[model samples]
Target chain A: MGRWEPNARGRLEQAALELYVERGYEQTTVAEIAGRAGLTERTFFRHFADKREVLFAGAGTLRDDLVSAAAQAPPGAPPIDVVATALAAVAAPFQGRLESVRRRQSVIEANAELKERELIKLASLSAALAETLRERGVAEPAASLAAEAGIGVFKVAFGRWVGEPGGGEFARIVREAVDELKAVAAGS
Target chain B: MGRWEPNARGRLEQAALELYVERGYEQTTVAEIAGRAGLTERTFFRHFADKREVLFAGAGTLRDDLVSAAAQAPPGAPPIDVVATALAAVAAPFQGRLESVRRRQSVIEANAELKERELIKLASLSAALAETLRERGVAEPAASLAAEAGIGVFKVAFGRWVGEPGGGEFARIVREAVDELKAVAAGS
Candidate 1:
């Protein structure tokens, strides 16, 4: 094989997720994941630190997208509005990937370590969004509260989106969740 | 020592926290913690599953307090208000423990594993609150959103309280945070 492999990361992630679901996360091996992806274990190691990384590799990109969108929001927009808009914008990419997303969620939910990683990823995203809001001149507590609340909304919306039988759009659910959060916060 | 140790759990927790702060969590051993508490290793294990459990031992009691408070809220209160009130009620216990709380927070922040465990505790708290809200007649997304949003407020408020030099009251800070979250969610 050549030194470069096209889409090796994606291939490995897909292979790992499939194996995790089929054989259990604890039962799966890195060599098996690489072999299923039709790549070498060396190539796998080059792409991901381990099999778990395959599940969480997209977190960095997701955080970047959310932060960039938040940073680009209108200067005069409210902090919560900025966060909500950013959430919807980032969720757009998950529109057609419900099946895989559900599979991934199941895999994470089945394992304590993966659940912790997922929480950590969400916490990191919240912190990044809070920093972006702070840069936008939003003050303390408000920035952190808005960012954390936005993540709370996202988590609830994402859970609903994944569990819904009718398969709703992730972006729409996020927008509705933001609105629900507002109503809930207002004690209405 | 006999099989019964007076305040064994409390003594072990205090000893563990002191050791974790003084010698770092990883360097501290179960034997050292027990020795510091003037108890035996058997007594320590009788109280907690492991060293990490010392830090998290209060989570269950905290959850129960929050749930009980939520369940006892006035019948007509909004879900968000119920959560906020429960949060304040539960936070009152931390009034005189700011120093220990700060030390515990630092220890958890210093280690990735402890941080993950902390997140799991918070997540579990959120889930229990959501369940309580659902039983209170709050609907799907609203129950979850309110529960999670309340946890967000608590997190930000607790962080600020720990970092503040003047050492304000935890319940007051939580109240202020809830109001701030309401304002932020209102997009003001």
Candidate 2:
């Protein structure tokens, strides 16, 4: 392989997901992922720490985007609205990648350990959002509540999107989920 | 030891928590937990499958209580209200167990594996609540949204209750948390 591989990280992720889907996650190996990507194991390590990291590496970037979007929302808006808007904004990246996202979800769902890792990532994202809300002058309980509830909306919305056969818009589903949560909270 | 030990289960739980808090969850062994409770390893195994089970055994009963309360909620109430009412009802069990709950929380917090286990338990509880809401005739996204949001409220409320210097009523805290979440969702 050449010293410079364009989109090596992307290729590794694609390869890893394909392999995980083909051969069960437990049976898949890092060497197989690297070889499938047409890259060396050393290059794979450069992109991800382990086989599991291939599935979760995007979570860090997603959290950063969410926090950034939340931090930049209108100052006087309600914490929940800020979080909702941020969540909607962050849904853009997943718009055109429905199949890959669905594949990733299936892989994660098939493995107990991956499912736990996904939950931990979601929990950490909620914590980060809460911290960002606090930074925005939102008080405790409210900030935490908004952050967690917002994530709850995302989880439901994302699940719905993945389960949809037509592959609808991600942000639209998120908006609807947020509205549903708001109505649910209002006891309507 | 006598063939019959009164409150063997309770004693094992108490001993496990103390040992986990004192010597750390990683360093504590099943043998030590049994010894601390004046029981044998056989007794410990009979009560719990393993050391982690000592901390998580109550989750099953808690889930049952929450699901039953949710199922019995007024037929005409909104999904979120049903969930909130059930959550408050379940808080009754933890009213006088603040110290032990806080210790367990600390122990779980100190260990990554335990924290992941705790997250899995919470996820399972949310799934159960969602299922109960579905059985109550609530629709798809709405059922999941209410259940997840309810769990989010519980997480924040329980955190506040545990963090308080002078312990407050768990049910009251849950109600207040539910109200705060409602206000947040309403963009107040």
- Tell me each candidate's TM-score: 0.96, 0.98
lDDT of candidate 2 at residue B172, scale 0 to 100: 94
In the range A112-173, model 2's lDDT, one tens digit per residue, is 99999999999999999999999999998899999999999999999999999998999999
Summing lDDT over every window of 10 consecutive residues in candidate 2 chain B, give the lowest-scoring window.
Answer: B1-10
In model 2, the Cα lDDT at residue A71 comes to: 96
Model 1, span A22-97: residue lDDT tens = 9999999999999999999999998889888889888999999999999999999999899999999999999999
Model 2 stretches with alpha carbons more than 4 Å out: A1-3, B1-3
Cα deviation of B109, candidate 1, in Å: 1.0
Mind giving the per-residue lDDT tens digits that candidate 1 earns over B101-183? 98899999999999999999999999999999999999988999999999999999999889999879999999999999999
* lDDT, each prediction: 0.93, 0.93
Lowest lDDT sum, 10 consecutive residues, model 2 chain A, at A1-10
Instruction: Highest TM-score: give the candidate number.
Output: 2
**All DockQ scores:** 0.93, 0.92
